[model samples]
Target: MILEVAVIFLAVLWVVTIAMFMGHTKRQRTLATQQVEADSLRDQRIRELARRLENYQGGTIRMGEELHELRATVAPLPDKITILEQRDPSTLSFAQAARLVTMGASVDELTQSCGLTQAEAQLMTKMHGNG
Candidate 1:
C-alpha cells in the first residue's frame, strides 16, 4: 500500500511540472511575437523619415541653384548702368535739361546751358516745367 501511494504522488508531481513548463513556453512565444511587431513598426518609421530627409535635401539643392542663377543674371546690371552714364554725353544733357525745366528755367536757358535744340528745350519745358 505504501509503495502504491508513493508512485501516484510522483505521477501527479510530473504532470504539474509539465503543465507549468508548457504555460511558460506559451507566454515566451507571445512575447516574441510582440517584439517582432514592434521592431517592424520601428523600421517602417525609420524608412519614412529617411524618405522625407531625402526630399528636403533635394529641394535645398534646387533652391541653391536657382539663387545662384538669379545672382548671375543680376551681376551685370550695375556695370551696365555705369557704362550708360559714362558713354552718352547727350543723356547727361537731357537729364540736366529736365532738371532745369523743373526748376522753372526757360526754353532759351535750357537751349544755352544744356545744348538742347529749340524744339527739344520747348518739349522738356512743356513736360517737366511747373504747372
Candidate 2:
C-alpha cells in the first residue's frame, strides 16, 4: 500500500514540474516579443528624423539656387531696352535685331519691326537654339 501511494505522489510531482516549466517558457517568449517591438519602434523613429532633416537641407539649397537664377535673368534687360528705344524708330536694322536676340530680347521688344509677336519670338528663339 505504501509503495502504491508513493508511486501516485511521484506521478503528481512530475506533472506539477512540467506545468511550472511550461508556464516559465511562455512568460519568457512574451518578454522577448515585447522587447523586439520596442526596438522596432525606436528604429522607425530614428529613420523618420533623418528623412526630415534631409528634406529641409534640400529645400534650402533649391531656394538659394532659384533666387540666384532670377537675379541673373532680370539684371541686363532694362539697359538693352533703353539702347534700342534711343535709336531711330523708322530705320531699325538687322544688326540691332540680332543684337537684341543675342541679349535674350523677345519679339515683344521688336513690336515696331514687322509686327513680330510672342509666338514669332518663341519660334525664332527655338530655331536659333536659344529657347
What are the Cα lDDT values of the candidates?
A: 0.88, 0.78
- Per-residue lDDT tens digits for candidate 2, residues 38-97, read 999999999999999999999999999999999899899999899878866775565556
Best model per TM-score: 1
Question: Candidate 2: misplaced stretches above 4 Å?
Answer: 55-131
RMSD of 2: 10.3
- Model 1 segments beyond 4 Å from truth? 77-131
Best by lDDT: 1
Residue 100, candidate 1: Cα error in Å is 12
Candidate 1, poorest ten consecutive residues by summed lDDT: 84-93
Tell me the tens digit of each residue's lDDT in model 1 across 1-131: 99999999999999999999999999999999999999999999999999999999999999999999999999999999898678646544687778888888998888887777899888998889753
The superposed Cα distance between candidate 1 and the true structure at residue 26, in angstroms, equals 1.1
Worst 10 residues of 2 by lDDT: 109-118
